[model samples]
Target: MFELHLRQKSTAFQIEKRCKALAKVIKARRAPPWPCVPTPELPAKVVSDALIECYLRTNETLLRVLHIPSFRRDYEAVWSPDSNPDPTFLVLLKLVLAIGATTYDESFSLRPSAVRWVYEAHTWLSAPDFKHRLGIPSLQANILLLIARQATGVGEDLVWASVGSTLRIAMYMGLHRDPAGLGPSTTTPMVAEMRRRLWNTILEIALESSLNSGGAPLISLDHFDTEPPGNFDDDQLTGAEGEVLVPKPDGTFSQTTTAIALRSMFPQRLAIVKYLNDLSSRGSYAETLKLDTELRAAYKTLTRTLQTCKTPTNGPSDLELRAVDLLLRHYFVALHLPFFAPALKETEFAFSRRVVVESALRLWRAAFPVPLSQLPTIDDPLARVAISGSGYFRTIAVQASIVIAVELTSLMREEESLGLGPVEVRPDLLTALDDFKVWSWKGMETGETNTKGYLVACLVWAQVDAMRKGMVEEEWVMEVVKAAEEAETRCLGLLEEIEARGRQPQDAPFGTATQGVGGDAVVTPDFGVGDWDYMMSDVLFNTAGDPLSWVFQ
Candidate 1:
């Protein structure tokens, strides 16, 4: 009966009239017959086709059917167990590494099975004989990619041991050509955290290697080291032939027999001279003269060191840069000390101004070879001096302006005390102030919206200093108020632009600042004293203080 049914269904007229009848009979047979033609025996082609089908199929049952154990079993039979572990590991590791590199937004989800597969692969890599069993180069390369991902802030402690091993393997690879390669990944929070734990491991290896090879210290100096020096110095001096003078038991000078002993003892004698001078400086002219002499000596030493030192080829050594920085800072502090402050008056401020100019010029030249326009602007003048190539000239100019502003205010205050009254404001002072204003304004215009607040702060400081010195004339006061008003308006505009660009959903936290501006409606910043508060405080204090009280008394 089944054969008759099949024969009837096979008839061309019956097939055309009812194709469903043949399908039903074929379904009833449970499986295809010998004459029904067997599937092709190209295992590779079959596995490839099955994988493709598995990838394409969306239905749950179709995916399950395509993912049947038989396909993987066949694949394992052909390529597994006997193939070189290196190529196999690399091929699989590349796929695993791709998970982090590719973007996966809200829609995509990693399967638990996929995660398990990655964990297993990592476990295999950690095995003791992995280096020998698998080709080390390919394995090392893949391991580096894995370490990079972890260092780029991808994974946690769960895989950190693997990361350490990978880093060690990379070190073994003699890969010092790219120190900056690790920098980017090390900056990420995940990687940064991992690095904190594993840093000792890296440090141990680096230190050992560095010691053996006579390499530079791990914490060698950079340009930031070249900031202005602070308030102390201990001196060491030697005689012409590198001989040292020593002190006798009775405090008289004596020549030492051994060159090494003389070298060590000469510094102690110099310290005695410094200690005695510190005690003798009892707020008198001689004391001031002594300080001035010491400072001149120190300045000469610092400048000679800076001029004679070789510029680094790769980057400035941190110690060298810091030494320069300390020298500059000390020079400034020395100029400001009560004893040296009068030096400015004697030189008509020329000496002090020249010192500042020379220091700035030297810093600019030493740290950067590029044109000023290419340098980046930063907050610190000393930093600019260290890294002169980053559009830092404008920042230097701004710093110069600030120094001049403070000096002008001080001069105006002193003149008023001398009954010269508030001296008419100079065009130069006004020009410096205006340049600073424009610098800030340009920042805002260029979409550096965050800079507006900082500029406003600087302006407030200038204004406060002027007011405190009683140098703020009525016209100058009015100019400051107008500038503050303009700044406020600009800040409001920038806030609007920030909100517009954000275009966040109504429910999102960042977009909540989009509502309203000015007078009770605007949101106050969480921190910082605002521009208006500073200006108002200055006005209120100046108004409250009795200007005529001293004269009347």
Candidate 2:
């Protein structure tokens, strides 16, 4: 019995030794685990590919990680403590990566792994506990890092989408924090840069996608899901007493009073009436024209108050008030210009024009003034003819010139339809158009640089209209042609300057060559000049041919 026991013990010891050796070998063969060293050879392309693979393979794990309180806290502490991870980021990133990878290797594509990572990150960063622990600064940093890491060409859409979410969240958080103060340090710079980049990217993507698909419809703003504010509840705010409340997407609430006011001002719901009334009492008007006037007055009054009032530097909400007022003024002006023009009497038009011109002049002179030597010789016949001895008079003259040009163009078109060679040119109308053209061109060339484009385009359109009617004399037609040529030259030169400053290559010229009046080949000017294509196109087409013939149609 003793000998048998000894043999068993010996066998057991041998077996144990072999097992230990096998365990050691297994561990040695495995990857050096925990905080695995990031691969050094991983190019951006490779990393992107790996990410996609990982996402596909371990989407659940990534999602779980994202949801984890600790992980979210850490992420928020670095990038966006106050906001949730934007879901847009995931979609955009996937799309971009898919496109980029397909470019180099068709087989390389966004997989479940990438999706998983995105979900995980989102879950982790959104936990309430994590948000509280992470400060804004840390959160912003993390956001930047996240974008930097995943912002490859393939994932640009995702990044941009994420950026939009981040901005909304940041804005909400900032507003929540102060009710008035703009949010964290990253708010201004990040928002501005993202806006600019996103705009360019969106344009390029839209154009390229359209081109590639042989006119296939491109993605639109409607494709993306935008979160509406939770506070938007019209029914809850509406009352039987005819009060209305309008909830702005930006979180502000407007109230209106009176049945007409409620319907006209907040057509969506009667609940907005109270809000409208409240704002109106503070100078908001139900009628757009009145509103514009009120807003302009508010700006002027507030500015004057700020100049005399004792307040903190950039404080007392003066600048903010002024900005809001200006925005409102511009909004009303644009809204009313189309349908309400005929309703405005001659006196009203003259008064409004005077106000606009004087206000613009005041703003310009305060910001930038011409030197004595640079000022135009007002005594000259041309200058004297342009200005009717007063600013208000000059404004009327300009308005009259525009009206005459339009009328002549209309008459000429009618005459042509009747098979008449051309319409008769009234001397007074011709003179007015020429004078306005000269005056406007002078303003474009020598006035406040800020208003140069606006003045030039306005003048160019007037000239084109006159020329198209065949009512303009040959000399005046020549002048109009010269103006067009000069405008084109100036625009090209400006574009070149911009390209030089940006260190970007010049783009190819656009449009086809068409015969001019003398049968000389003149390239139909490209509409790409000076970021004012909307205005320029009107001038080019209205004068040259049918206005409706364009891609925009």
**Poorly placed runs, candidate 1 (over 4 Å):** 1-292, 306-331, 334-401, 410-435, 438-472, 499-553
Question: Candidate 1: minimum summed lDDT over ten consecutive residues — where?
Answer: 58-67
How many residue-pair clashes does candidate 1 contain?
Answer: 23
State in Å the error of residue 510, model 2.
Answer: 36
lDDT of 1 by residue, 1-553 (tens): 3234324433322322332343233223322222221111112333333323322221111101111232233334434434322223222332232232111111112222123333433433434553332222233234433432322222322233344454444334222112224344212222122222222223322322222222322322220111111111102111123223223332211111111121222222233223333344345545434544565565555444433433344222343344234323333433333323454467754555555534443433333323333445433322332221112223333444455455556556656666754455554444444444544544443333344333454545456445544554664455455444455555555545544544544341221111111122211112111121111122111323333222111
Q: Summarize candidate 2's per-residue lDDT along 1-553 as a digit string, tens digits.
A: 3234324433433433443454344323321332221111112434444434432222111111111222223322223324323222322233323222222221122222222333333443444443331223223323432332232221333443444444434433321122112223323322222222223222222222222222322233333322212222223332223333334332122111111111122111111222223233332224545555554555455445434433344222332233223222332323333333342334445444444433433322221122212444432221321221112123333444444455445445546567665456555445444555445444333211222333344445544455455553544445554444455445334433433433454332222111111122121112111121111222221223343222122
Error of 1 at 381 (Å): 12
